[model samples]
Target: MSVPATPMERSVPRDARTSTARMLMICAWLSLAIVVVLSLSIGATGITLAALPDAIQHWLAGSDDDATAARHSLVLLEIRLPRTLLGLFVGAALAVAGAMMQGLFRNPLADPGLIGVSSGAALAAVATIALGNEFAAPWIGTFGPYALPISAFFGGVITTWMLVAVAGRHGQLMIGTLLLAGIAIGALAGAMSGLIAYVSDDRELRDLTLWTLGSLSGASWPKVIAVTPFAILIAFAIPRLIRGLNGFLLGEAEAFHLGINVEATKKFVVVTTAACVGAAVAVAGVIGFIGIVVPHFVRLIAGPDHRIVLPASALVGGTLMVFADILARMLVRPAELPIGIVMAAIGAPVFLHLVLKRGIGGVE
Candidate 1:
């Protein structure tokens, strides 16, 4: 259970001052735009930022006569653009999903990963990699290139549904019950994934290992399309859930007393989070820290206003992911490091500092 904030804290307008929120929003937008441009312009190929307009023009105008322009266009259009877009969508999805989960649970640490979604997705992906020729043959045959992503998406959805079922009492969903059930389910899913990994051949092991570590190296236009709808779903949800999430900070009973449809809010959050995290995991593998770290960081900057935190988290998260992807490409030169590793290296110390300095008193 979350510790309730004091009366003085609750009395703050919108749970954040307007000036701070506005400034954060401005900074977030600028940061995102800058990082996105950099992500497209910088890579192992040494593409200069100034040349992007020409490259884009060449690509759009279908001019292959200039070999230099053609190469730049190919790199920009086919590779970096899709990869950058994937980072944006995946990052935004995870961050907003994290913010929503934290608000719903009234816990500062809450994220999609807390509820077994990532674990379930990882388990399914690993299983597909390890057992596709055997147990998953039919689905693999049908899905072909799409089999792993499909498995991951459904795996997350199924796990959340099971969590909901186990945590429901009478007609109401208990936050405490849901949290406990999620932890148990997440642990179980992790164990199952480990078991599958244990029995896999060397080739299967390599594939699953890399998949779990996470990357945008496999990013393409299809993946960008696949994850975009879920990102839009999360965007649409933020406005509707803002009031409920704010009221939730006062506790479920208080939210109910405030005329918020607590049950409906809970269900919507669960469904949206499942889809968002599922699509993100399906495309980028299990990139961690963005969900937990981005929202918390946003709250620190913008205050606890869901109005500020949600959208700001989306911007900051997307910025961070694109920046991280750039680092992943450049840090090891031609051989890329897993983006997940880069995220952990960047996020862990920051999270530890926040916890130590602020104490975990549940998002006040």
Candidate 2:
């Protein structure tokens, strides 16, 4: 029989925890709505809140020959709208991936960037850009918009498989081993990327620079459409993983004893993470920190239950990127900073606080 619990061993009651978790979800969605409105309202063009209704209505009602409406439609529908949507999707994807990784590894620092997924995706994308015009011209011409994303997805999946092989030992995953191997892989990938960047012509060089650093300036209907399926699938998939992830926090053996298929869950997580991160990297280059930081922030407010952390992470992550994109636009006037830089700037403080509060020896 299980031993009797002391006061410290007692946990929050189920109904109470569920009540609070529901409230957290409500708040997260509400905040995301506010951020979206703010993102729409603030942009380079003279579009204001008042103009938004007519601008959207005009687009929905069919094209207007009026120059003013045309300009508003161009700015809102073509540019800001897609950019905001991309941020939302990419941010939500990275955050969900990070949360799952953290829960699987049982560590806060198990980031996509640190685990070789992002770097591998980046390397493949850079290689695609480097070779697209010269070697893969036929594929590029045939695939047109999808060639790079396809390559990135395969690269991310392969890298995740390799990482798991390297990091798994004695039928267990070691956080430290994964960290060390990830660093080595990331270094090699970075070096390869740099070498490719060195031999490129001006336009190729420009593509390399933008993609390597990361940005949402390339957001368009095509890019947005490319990422939608991954984001939606991940969103749809999160509900299924909650029970396994929650059990994981108690320990894997306990999870298995509770009737969980531990091996299947691990494989599912790795595969889903690869798909999510791969799609985000393909479209947005490589915005980092969101994956590592947003889930922790959600945990701070909503508690560490994966049921709460996963969905809350999605909403909070979407809200964060939407506002970050807004700040990126307004920070340097007409010239915008890379969204990656913006994420790092915001995530640094949050990460520092988590480290300090949790301490190196006390990250559970």
**What's the lDDT for candidate 1?**
0.89
Candidate 1: regions farther than 4 A off: 1-16, 361-364
| Candidate 2 residue-wise lDDT, 99-182, digit = tens | 998988788777788778888888888989987788888878998878887777777877887877998877666656766787
Which number leads on lDDT? Answer: 1
Residue pairs clashing, model 1: none
**What TM-score does model 1 achieve against the real structure?**
0.93
- Give the alpha-carbon lDDT of every model: 0.89, 0.83
Off by over 4 Å in 2: 1-20, 164-183, 357-364
Q: What RMSD, rounded to one decimal, does every model reach?
A: 4.9, 3.8
What is candidate 1's CA lDDT for residue 156?
A: 93
Instruction: Show the lowest summed lDDT stretch of 10 residues, model 1.
Output: 355-364
TM-score of each: 0.93, 0.88
What does the lDDT come to for candidate 2?
0.83
